[model samples]
Target: MKQILIAEDEPDIQELLCAYLEDAGYRTTVAGDGAQALAVFGGQPFDLVLLDLMLPGIDGFGVCEVIRRQSQVPILMLTALDGEESQLRGFGLDIDDYVTKPFSMPVLLEKIRVILRRRGLAGPESRLHYRDLSLDLDTREVLLAGRPLELTAREFELLHTFLAAPGRVFTREMLLARLWGYDFYGDERVVDSHIKNLRHKLGRNYIETVRGVGYRAAKADR
Candidate 1:
């Protein structure tokens, strides 16, 4: 999974951003100020950074300068600074993209997707494999034990999600939001239905119920 560092002071926006990103399958770390952002950035590798310009200490520019000097990790500036000068300065500092406040979550997600895809950080592989199963991402084909297996679109996505992150239990709500979008008002039990179909098709050993939590991909046997 991709790791994203979010540097924002406002608690509401920080929580909102983290929830959306996590639902979309990215691991996120939060930093309330520029100093904290820098400290977190230096300690580990991250696929991307969501920066807020008006941070409490050091400021976004200072943080960007320090990070730019060390690594080329993609940075997307999320601030209320919409002026041409502010944007020009952010671009000049080598930020991959910039989004002014009051932005739509869908648009922000798309921007993150595009930036990661462009940088080759997104999952661009032709196929995904687990034990005897293989999924062709490009062709939307699945093979089981070297034989072709047919599946519905929802089943394919559910399997793909599970195979992408083995052992990551996905709640029905998370699966619904990620797969069906927030506008989906249908019963959440739809996720259970689809999972049942997938297990029927792929075999029960591939997915395991987490009892109270959700479901995760079963680990390969020794």
Candidate 2:
């Protein structure tokens, strides 16, 4: 069974989330603080994480940064703060998604399902392929033209996002939001720089520039 970790402080919210997740046929673990969350995460393997932004010991962003350094586990941040800054900060920390505090249980469950589906963990088949490019979501491996391509964590994420839905136009902001997380205050040029580097290493033709729009993967030949 897929395990989901919920790092939330509020007992009421935690109970609600646990009940919903359990109903969805998932194994659930709860941590009331960031410290305990980290401990639980270190001790066992979890398929997904539902993280709360506010905590007693360590803040959610700090926990996210630390966990990201050690693992690529998908994180969905829950916050009562609805400002763009908080959302962006969570994203910058590599959070997979963000949910506002006054959220509905059904919506939260749907978001969890969507994230897992996108990561290929909730589906029966966990592999995605397009043309000569292939990604193993579970193992975090990428291959091109029958050969493995060495990619950094960010590069892998960028490529994964693009390949998830080929031919889709993703603006720099969108890409940054998905790859860098929401609270990134850095230059938008970072996206261009990464694309440039990715193109140089992967192949110039692998990612196509849409000029005023953004970047996209080349369409597969039918």
Candidate 3:
């Protein structure tokens, strides 16, 4: 069974989240503070983490940075603060997803499911490969030229999406929605930024940008 760790200070919210996750058939561990959360995480194996921005001892961002330094476990940030700046900060920390407070349990559960699905831990292999480039969805590892390529969380997701359907043109808006987890919000440049970084690491010629449409992986023969 997939395990999840939830770090929230509010007793009521903690219980609610635990119950919902359990009902979804996920094994859950709960911590009321960031310190305790890190303790639990260090002591056990968890497939994912649901973290609140506000916590006693260490803040959520601190916990996230520390955890990221050690593991690539998917992290979902839960916050009462609903500002673009706060959300951008969470993204900068490489969070997989973010949820605002006053959220519905059903929506939260759905988000959890989506993240798990995207990670390919909830199902069989969803890997894609071409030439020496290989992406293992279950292991969340990308190997290029038989050597592992270290990528940020978002970059991995974006590359995975492209490799899943090679030769298919993906508009910038589509990529932003599928990988970034939302609509344009007047910031389509985010897709360009990620693509630029991905190409820089993967290969300048790996992804082809269609002049008037979008991007597609360069054909194997071409």
Q: lDDT for every model?
A: 0.85, 0.80, 0.80
User: TM-score of the candidate numbered 2?
Assistant: 0.55
Per-residue alpha-carbon lDDT of model 2 for 44-108, expressed as tens digits?
99999999999889989988988999999999999989999999989988899999977755456
- Name the runs in model 2 displaced over 4 angstroms: 123-222
Better of 1 and 2 by lDDT: 1
Per-residue lDDT over 1-222 for candidate 3, one digit per residue giving the tens place of the 0 to 100 score: 689999999876776666545534678888989889999999988899999999899999999999999999999999989999999999999999999977755456657777988887782244667767998755678999888999998888777666656788878866664554332366888888988999999874778899889998888876
Give the distance in Å from residue 169's predicted Cα in candidate 3 to where it truly belongs.
Answer: 50
RMSD of each: 5.9, 12.8, 12.8
lDDT of 1 by residue, 1-222 (tens): 899999999887787688767756789999999999999999999999999999998899999999999999999998888999999999999999999986666567768878888998873454789989998865779999999999987788788778877878888876776667544679988899988888898764799889989888898972
lDDT of candidate 3? 0.80
Q: How well does each candidate superpose onto the true structure, as a TM-score?
A: 0.59, 0.55, 0.55
lDDT of 1: 0.85
Which 10 successive residues of model 3 have the least lDDT summed?
176-185
Q: Candidate 2 — what's its lDDT?
A: 0.80
